[model samples]
Target chain A: MKILVCVSKTPDTTSKVAFTDGNTKFDEAGVQWIINPYDEWYSLVRAIELKEKDASVVIHMVTVGGADTEPIIRKALALGGDEAIRVNSDSTDSYYIAAQIAEIAKQGGYDLIFTGKETLDYNGSSIGGMVAELTDAPYISLATKFDLEGTTATVTREIEGGEEVAEVALPAVVSCQKGMAEQRIPNMRGIMAARTKPLKVTEPVAADALTAIVNFELPPAKAGVKLVDAENVEELVRLLHEEAKAI
Target chain B: MSVLVFIDHADGHVKKSSLEALTYGAKVAAQLGTSAEGLLLGTVTEDLAALGKYGVTKIHQAANEALNNLDTQVYAAAIAEAVTASGATVIIFSHTPTGKAVAARVSAKLKAGLVTGACALPDTSNGFVVKKGVFSGKAFANVSINTAVKIISLNPNSYMTVAGEGTAAVAPLAISAGAAKVKVTAVNKVSGDVPLTEADIVVSGGRGLKGPENWGILLDLAKVLGAATACSRPVGDAHWRPHHEHVGQTGVQVAPNLYIAVGISGAIQHLAGVNRSKIIVVINKDPEAPFFKAADYGIVGDAFEVLPKLTEAIKKMKASA
Candidate 1:
């Protein structure tokens, strides 16, 4: 089985979200970027697990970013991918990125493609489904468990109320969330092997996105906490009615 | 000119998010100097004409069983055909799983510019710019779309749902339908009173609830308040609850009117899913918990002790009312 995973570099979840240029763009000036958490935990880990079972399983890592994201791509390779491909252009929007990935996967003849359900930064879970549509592949979002036998892949997706198990065929795309696998850390040997692996950079095919970012801003600050006296139960009830209106 | 809104339904009832999307679409339609019409893909039990209260003037219902389950290709094709038939220049959808998929496919089909997860109305002074949540609800980004036909998927709970006296007229849509490539074998639904994603009130617990054995306090509170129950990532990871009830950066993202966190430390990952709640209440024995700072109300007490009293008080109030 050939599995392709799309990883994106986003700011670590703890970073203070701020914008520069009069709040026109995200201030990437002094922030650390890590692999999108969902992509790392679900998409990448499951791909590695499949590679272990089928030695013929080739795990291909792809990213849409400039040269700065190479280190993250290399780290993914160290985590256990056979090869890496970097689209040598900064993706301006989710559609452009999805187009680039779909184009590549179409040319490569991938049996399965996986992506994190949503990016932590953009919060756009559109890439996987968009790619699936672009390539005319079946898509299953938020998969927790994925298994393959013959050409059928049984996937379990965590929904709002419960789990949904699906049976899909080959040449499918999946957007993965948690409960996919036990987290894995790169070992010394895997890290050393990654150094010797080939990292290819290819020019992006010409495709213009129809949308563009107008500006970026942070949400309003949360109000200071209000502590009501525990003894004043009536006050709490009244506040729940008048102030919070949560009752 | 007219705006088209996709109406999402599940198990015969229309979803709350779709109503909000309808309201959003209607508001956008007004802003664009156009009328708004709705397109229903699947079967629904609710009165279609009553939906006019949300500002839509007409409804195009395609009562096909093939649409009971979501198939983006079929939905996109159907919506595009409806748009063409209705002479719609703008399209709207909710930022749910089905909406995201169908909107993109429709955008490609119509060559329209799309803005997903829009939180506010567009600024049409110069061009069409829509504001949306970025950085997992930590920040906002304004995207400008310059296209002949535009597409937008509104975020849940961002726009207030408004109703008017106008009731829409229903019109049955007659279009050639195709068989869906995928089929739903069985639906292994998670058993709960309220769907977690669309719940108005949510009560979530974390590791501080101690263990799965002591989750009664959380459930008791949720039951009394008629709220959906959720857990932090650690609790779900521990198998105390199913992974589907997990709400965090890597889990389900919800925007309830009220989110009450019990024994939760409020990690950034967890907050990403729920920061959109209008009001937040954090109850914990430790006063130094991180959630208190973001909470509108904070209570420093043990969950075992506080939760029971809270549930009792709410039940008494409901009975009195």
Candidate 2:
């Protein structure tokens, strides 16, 4: 079985977010990057698990970013991926990125594809579904559990008030979240092997973006919190009803 | 052309978030000098005509039992057919789990410009700019969707529902229900009175609650306030709470009308999941806890002492009313 796992680089959770160029672009200076937690902990790990169960299963990691993102790809390779593909482009649009992945998937004829449910930075949660549509393959979002037997795959996804247990055939797309798999740190042997693993770079196919960013603005700073005495609980209720009107 | 709102439902009733989307779509239609219509794909026990109070003039029901469960590919195809039949210029969704899964597929099938997690109405004064959260609610982006057809999925709690006196005209719309590639075998419902995603108020605790044994106090508070229960990641990681209750960047992100955090020193990841909430109230022993910085109200006290008192006070207020 061959699986393609989509990876994205995001600012560390603790990074102080900033914008520049009159709030049109993100300020990348002084920012530390990490493999998005969802991608590392859930999507990639699940693919690695599937490979572990079957010796012939191979995992390929793909990302659409500049060369600076190679280190993150290598990190994913160290975790378990057999090879990596870097789509050399700054992926600012979700549709264009999906189109690029769709092109690659069409050419490779991968049996399965995985991506984080959504990126923390943009939180679009659109690419995986779009890729599924473009490829005419089944797509499952926010899958928490997955099992595979031969050509059939069973996935469990959380929906409103309950969980939906779904079964789809091979050659499907699944976006993963928590409860799918536990995070795995790279072992020393895995690290050494990743250094020699092939990291292929490819150009993006021609595709037009449907949306454009006009500008960026930071959310308004939170107002000073009104602190109420621990003993004066009613005062808190008064403020909730009268000032905040939250109740 | 009219505005189309997708009315998501489960357990035979329309979800509350759909009402917000309906109201939002109606208002958008009002702004565009058009009418608002709704598309109901599955079997529902609710009165579809009663939804007119939210501002939609017509409700289109597919009444296909196969559409009862959410299958993204199936839903997207049916909704696309409805869009073509109704000539809907703009489509609205509530950005729930169902919406997140299907909206993109619909957009792809229709080749429409799609925006999710939208926090406000489109700025039509410009060339159709929609405002949505970026950087996980730490920043906002004004996105211009330059497509003949546009799709907007509003954040769950961002829009308020405005209802008035009216009944909608219910009509059966014919559309082909594509075969679902995935077969659902079973459903395991989360055992809670309110689903966290749809809850108006969420009362969450953290490690500061000490242990699972002390959760009774927090649960009591949640019961009094009629809020769903949640936990910080640390509590879930420690196995003191179920993983489903964990709310953070890696967990379930929620945007409710009110979020009450007890004993949780808001980590950046935790805040990312909840910063979109309309109002936040934090209670912690340390006044310098980072959660307080993002909170509208703070109470410096121990959770053990605060939980009971706060619950009692709310109970008193309710009884008097």
Candidate 3:
């Protein structure tokens, strides 16, 4: 089985979010970057688990970013990706990125494509479905469990109040979430092997973005917490009704 | 060319979030000097005419059994056909599970620009800039869409639902929904009194609860307050609570009207998943717990002692009302 895992770089959860240039762009200074947790923890780990079960399964990692993103891609390869492909372009629009990935998937003839349900930074959950639409393949979003037998794959996805189990054929797209798999730490042997593995960089296809970022701003600061006396539990309820109106 | 809103339904009734979406779409249409219309993909038990109070002038119902269960492909196909037939310039959806599943597919089929989890109405002064919460609600981004047709998924609980004095004209929609390539074999449901994502108030516990057997107080409090029950990641990891009831960064991200944290230390991951909530109340034995910093109200007390009292107080208040 051929598996393609899409990876992206995100600021560590502890990093302070800020904007610059009249609040028009994200400020990246002094921000520690890591492989998006959804990608590293769920998508790639599940693919590696599949490869562990079947030694013949080959897993490839793909990312759309500038030269700065290669390190994150290398990190994914260290974790267990057999090869890496970097589309030489800054990740701009979701559609453009999805188009580039669709082009690669078409050329590579990958049977299974996996991505984090949504990128942590943009929170755009549109790419995997868009890629699936472009490729004319079945797509499952927020998949918590996946099992493959021959060409058919059984998947479980979170719906309104429960989980729906579904079956899809090969050459499908899946956006993975937490229940899919656990995180894997790269061993010294895997790190050494990743250094020698193939890392291919290619130019992106022609695509135009339909949306532009007008500005970026942080949410309003939270108010100081009001500590109610434990004995005055009624005071808290009264405030919830009068002040917060949240009751 | 009117604003079209997708009315999501389950158990034969329209979801509350969908009503909010309808009101938002109507507000947008009123801003643009046009009317708002709604499209129902499946059969619903409610009176379609009564939905006009949400400000929609027309309701298009497609009562196909295949449409009852959500299939992104089938929904996208049917909605795309509706968009073409209605000549809708803008489409609105509630940023719930169904919206997240189908909006992108419809956007791809129509080559439309989509903004998911939009927290505010579009600013039409310059062009069309929609403000959305990004980075797990830690920040906001104003996105400018240049496409002729635009699609937006409004965040749940972000907007208010307003009713007006109007009645809608219901009409049957003629469209064919193709068979889905992905087949749903079974559905395993959580029997919670309130759905976690749709709940207005969420009462969550953490490792401080100690074991699964100690969950009775939390459930009792949730039941008295008419809230949903959730747990932190560690509690779910320890199997003291089911994974579906977990609400954190790696778990379910919920933005309820009121989020009460009991026995939770509030790690950054946990906060990331819930910071968007309107009001946060923390109850912990440790006064130095990090969750207090983000909470609107804090009570440093033992959960074992505080929970029952709070539940009793809420029950008393409800009984009086």
Query: True contacts preserved, each candidate?
Result: 0.55, 0.74, 0.66
Off by over 4 Å in 2: none
Off by over 4 Å in 3: none
Q: What's model 1's overall lDDT? A: 0.84
Clash list (residue pairs), candidate 3:
none
- Local accuracy of candidate 2 as per-residue lDDT tens digits, A24-73: 99999999999988899999999999988898998888899999999999
> Can you write out model 3's per-residue Cα lDDT over A92-194, one digit (the tens) per residue?
5887888899999998999999999887888888888888887878888899999999999999998777888999888899989989998888999888888
Which residue window of length 10 is worst by lDDT in model 2 chain B? Answer: B184-193
Question: Please, what are the lDDT tens digits per residue for candidate 2 over residues B88-199?
Answer: 9999998888998898888888888899999999999979999999888889999999898999999887898999989999999888767898888898887756999889
If both were scored by DockQ, which would come out higher, candidate 1 or candidate 2?
A: 2
Give the Å error, residue A98, model 2: 0.4
Please identify model 1 stretches exceeding 4 Å from their true place: A158-160
Which 10 consecutive positions of candidate 3 chain B have the poorest summed lDDT?
B187-196
Q: How much lDDT does each candidate structure score?
A: 0.84, 0.91, 0.89
Q: Report lDDT (Cα) of residue A214, candidate 3.
A: 84
- Candidate 1, residues B149-181: lDDT per residue as tens digits? 888998877887898878898888876757665
Question: Could you tell which candidate, 1 or 3, scores higher by lDDT?
Answer: 3
The DockQ values of the predictions, listed in order, are 0.62, 0.80, 0.77
